[model samples]
Target: MFNHPQAERKLEIQPNCIGDHVRRETVAAIEVSGDHAARSHIPKITALTLQCRGGYTLEAELGISPNGYAEPDYLGWEVKQYGVRDFVNYLAKSPVTLMTPEPTGGLYREQGVEAFLRRYGYPDKSGKPGRINFGGIYANGRDFHADTGLKLVLEGFDADKGKITNVDGQIALIDRDDVVAASWGFRGVIGHWNRKHAKAVYVPSLMRAPPPEYAYGARVELCEGTDVLLLLGALASGAIYYDPGMKMERADTPAPVTKRRSQFRVRHNDLTTLYQASVHENIDP
Candidate 1:
C-alpha cells in the first residue's frame, strides 16, 4: 500500500525517500478528485476526438503534459492508466504496452521501413487501398507466424542465468533463411525500459463518453526496482511479446506514408513479474 514504509524503500531512493513523496502526492491527487468524472485533457482540434482519453485525463489530474521524453512522467515515477470496467473489479481491458522502440538493426534498418514492409508485409486486412501492414503476435519460443513468416528470437539471453549475456544482443525477427528482418538491441530496449519503468504507478480507471470523460479508480498499483535482467527473463519465457502495428499507406506511390509501431506488451497479471516489489493501495479517503 502507498502508506507502507517498506514499499517506499523498495525503490532504494536514499536520504529523503523521494518515492514516498511521489506516492503521497499521487494518492492526494486521486483523493482530492473525489468521485467526479474528469473531462478530456486533449488539446481541442476542431471535430477531433481521441477514443483513448483515460490516460490523458488522469495525466491532466496529476498536472502531467504529454511529451516524447523517455523518462518517468511525474517526479521520477511513470504514471500509467489502465481501463477497467469497474474500479472495484479492476479488470484489465487490454494488455499493457511496455515500450515502442523501432528496430535499431536488421533489414528494417538497412533497407528502410518501406522495403521491409514490401518484403514481409501483407495486404491490409481491412481492404484499405494502397496499404500494406506488418502486423502479428510474435512471441518468444513460438514458431514462425503463418502470415509473416518470421519467428521471434532472443539473442544473447541465458534462460538459465536469467540475465542478458550480451549488451549488443537483440530481440529479433528472423525468416526461414535466418535473415534478420527486424530487431531491437539490448541497450535500446533496456535503456528505454529502465528510464521510464524503473519506478512506475499504474492507475485503473473507468471511462465513458457522451461528451467524453474518465473516472480514475481508488485502487492504484505502485511498482519499483525493475532491471534489464528481469525484462530479458520475461522476454525469453514468452511472457512479453512483440505486437507491432506497422503499416505503409499509399504503397504504390513514390513517396508513400509509413507508420512504425514496434511494441512490446504483457498481460496485466504478468506486470508484477518484472518488478522487485508491487503494492496495490486504496487511495480513497
Candidate 2:
C-alpha cells in the first residue's frame, strides 16, 4: 500500500490547495485499494476512488458534460490514467488531442462536408470508405504534403500583427482538386489551446491487469498560462506535429462524410517545457 505523509492531514481543501491536496488524497486512496481483478472498467475505478477519498462522483468517461462546467473531475482536477505497458521507462506513450474542428474555408467550406468527402474519402484499413487525415513534420517553404502534392506557404504568421497562418496561408485540408477542403484559422486553434491550459491539471496514472486490473496515480503535472505560448512555438518549430483522428461516416446520408479530429501532439519527454510543475514518484503499486 502507498503511504503519503499528507494523507493523514484530512485538511479541507481550498482553491489554492486543490492541486496538492487532490494529488495526495488520490495517491492514498489508490494505495489503500491495492490491486484487484480486472472486474471493472477504467471509469468505474476512477469513480470509486474519487468518491471514496474526494467525496465526489464523476462520469466514467474522460470528457466534460454538456451542462457541466470544466473542473478535471468533481474536485476540479483533471484525472488521466493510462496502461502501464504503454509507457517506456519514465515516458508515457499517449498522444494529446489538441483540436478537432472541421475546416473553415475554401472549397471544403463551400462544397460542404458531403462534397469534400466524395472527393477525398478513401478505403480505410478496414476497407471501409473513410477520410484519412494526414500531418507531418513541416518546415517553412517545405512540401509538408509531398504525397498529396500540397505545398506549405506561410501567410499570416506575423508576431507584431498577432496573427498566425499555416503552410497554405490557411489551416486546411486540401483535395486532389487543389481546393481547400476544410480549414482552421490560427486564432481559432490558439484560443482553444489557451482555454485548455487555463484549468489544466494532469493526473497521470499507471494501470496493470491480470485477473484484477489495478491502477495508481503516479504523478500530477500542472501547466501555467504562459506554457501555451511555448506550445505554440513548438508547433511552429515542428517539434510538435499534427495527428488527425478518423471517424466513420454515418450511413443515413446520401453522401456520407467521415469526420477527422485534428490534433497537435508531442512526445512525453517534451512535456517538461509545456508544463510548469510535475510531481512524480508519489505512488508505487
Candidate 3:
C-alpha cells in the first residue's frame, strides 16, 4: 500500500529524537477514566499492624534484630512512649509521640498498656503481664502513603449484604444492587514476593470469561473443575500486607457499602518478621 518510496522512507524513520524536529506532545499509555480517577483518590485500608504503645513513632524499618545482622532483620519499627507523666498528659492531650519522624498516620492507636487494661480488661481476671492489655487501631490505606483505592479482595471473606452477580475473568464486576458495577481483581503469586515460586494465573470470571488471549505474558493453565463458589467464598477486602516475598495478608472487616470500595490485608503466617507483641489503636475520629 505504499504510494511512493520517499513516503515509505518517512515511515522507516524512528520517532523524532531531538531539537526542533522533536515532537513536544505525547499521549499517556494508560488513560484513567472519571470514576477510576475518583477511586484512585479515595483511600482504602491497605494493611493493619498492631501498635503497642500509648502513641509511638513508626519509621519504615522499626524492629530489633534477633541475630544482630548488619541491617535490621526486622522491618517496620514501633515505639511506646508511655511514661507515668506521659500517660497523665496523654489522657488530656491524646497520644504522646515524636512529631519529627512522624507516626504512621491513620493508625488505630490503643491506649497505654495500663490504661487499656483498665478500660477493656475483665473484672474477673487479673493478669497484669500475661497478654491482657491489648488495644488496637485500623488505619486507612492512605495513612501508609500506599496506593489508595487499590485493595486485594479475597473471594470469600470480603462481601456485602448481597450476593455477587457478575464476574469477568480476573476482574469481578459485582453489581451489589445498591450501586453500579464494581470491579474486583484476582491474581495468585507464590507467597508474597517469591517470584521463583511456580506462579500461575487464577482469575475467576466477573462477566464473560476472557478468552485465552487474556493470559498473554504469564502462563495460563485453566482449572477446568474449579467451582465459582470457591472464588466467591475466598477472602475479600482489607489491606494487603506487603511482606516482600508475600504481598497479600488478610485483615479487618470493611465498612459495608456496595459499589467498588475496598480494603486489603495479608495472612498471619506470611508476616514472619512481625513481632508477636506489636500493637496500636487508631486515634478516635
Candidate 4:
C-alpha cells in the first residue's frame, strides 16, 4: 500500500494536472525490501511465462488495474519493467520489447496467420516434430533471412524528411516471390506508440521463481515526447528492427495451434533516441 494521504493532498492541489503520485508510490514499493508475487491486471496471467512475470509483479506492487486501452499504465505514464542481475550498475544492456503489433496487411492478414506460416515459415529449429516457425531479426538493408527467405522493407516513409509520407505506409516482410508475407501499417503502429508511450517509465528488476517473484530496483528511467516520426526514422535507419516469433504446432493436423508475436525492439542504450528527453532518477531517494 502507498501513502494515500499525501497522494490525496497532491491530487487535491493539482486537479487535472500530472502529479508525483506515481513516483511516490514507486518509491514506496521500492522500500518494501522483498520479492513480490507475479501479478498484473492488464495481462492477467493464466500461465506465468519466464519473460513476463517481472513486469506483472511490478505492476501488482504499483496498484495498477486492467484498463483495456492503448493508453498509459499509471497516472498518465506507461510503466514497464526489465530484468537485471542487480540494482548496482542498473543500466542493463538488454533489448527492450517495445510493442507487439500484429500485421495489418499482407498474406499474414489476408490469407490468415496459419497459411502465411506454412508458406513462409521454416521447420522448428529445435526439431520439434510437426512444428513450423517464422522468426528472425530483420532490418533495413539486411538480406533475406537464410532460413525464412524473407526480407524486411519499409513502404512510404521518407528517411530524409524523418516523417511518414503516407499514412498507408507499412513495415513489410517480402518473400522471394514478391509476396508480402506480413505487414504492419503506419497508422496503427504509430497510434499505438504515441498513445501508450507518450510518457513512459522503465523499471529494472531482479527475478526468481518456481512460483515467480520479483524485486524492483530503485532507479528508474523516465522518457517523454514520443512521436511516430521518431519511431519511423529508427525503423528506416535499422536502429529498431522487426523480430517476430510466430509458429504453428501440430502442423500435420487440420487444426494446428498457432502463436503470434510480432515485435519491434530497440536496445536499452538506444531508448533515448526514440524520445525527445530521457532521464534516470532514483525513486528511493
TM-score per prediction, in order, is 0.83, 0.58, 0.17, 0.83
Residue-level lDDT of model 4, residues 130-190, one tens digit each, is 9999888999879999988999999999999887778899999998888998888888887
- Weakest lDDT window of 10 consecutive positions for candidate 4: 5-14
lDDT of 3 by residue, 1-285 (tens): 112211111111111222342232221111212121112333321111222321211111122222212221111112222222121121212222211110111111223223322333232234322233221222222222122112222332335642444332232211223121222233222111122111111111111112110000011111112222322332222222221111111111132111111222333222212111111211111
Best by lDDT: 1
Ranking by TM-score: 1, 4, 2, 3
Q: What stretches of model 4 exceed 4 Å from their correct place?
A: 1-51, 66-68
**Rank by lDDT, descending?**
1, 4, 2, 3
Measured by TM-score, how close is model 3 to the native structure?
0.17
Q: Distance (Å) between predicted and true CA of 214, model 3?
A: 46
Model 4's C-alpha root-mean-square deviation from the true structure amounts to 6.0
How well does candidate 4 score on lDDT at residue 165? 78
Candidate 2 lDDT over residue span 1-285, tens digit each: 122322221212122333542333332232133333222554334444432221112123232232223233434444433323323343554654433455567655787655554445443545554433333433333553643344333345543443444433444555446555556666655565565454444443343222223233344454433344565555555556655554446434565555655555666666556654543443333
Task: Write down the RMSD of all candidates, one decimal each.
Answer: 6.5, 8.0, 25.5, 6.0
In terms of TM-score, which candidate is strongest? 1
**Residue 181, model 1, lDDT:** 96
TM-score attained by model 1: 0.83
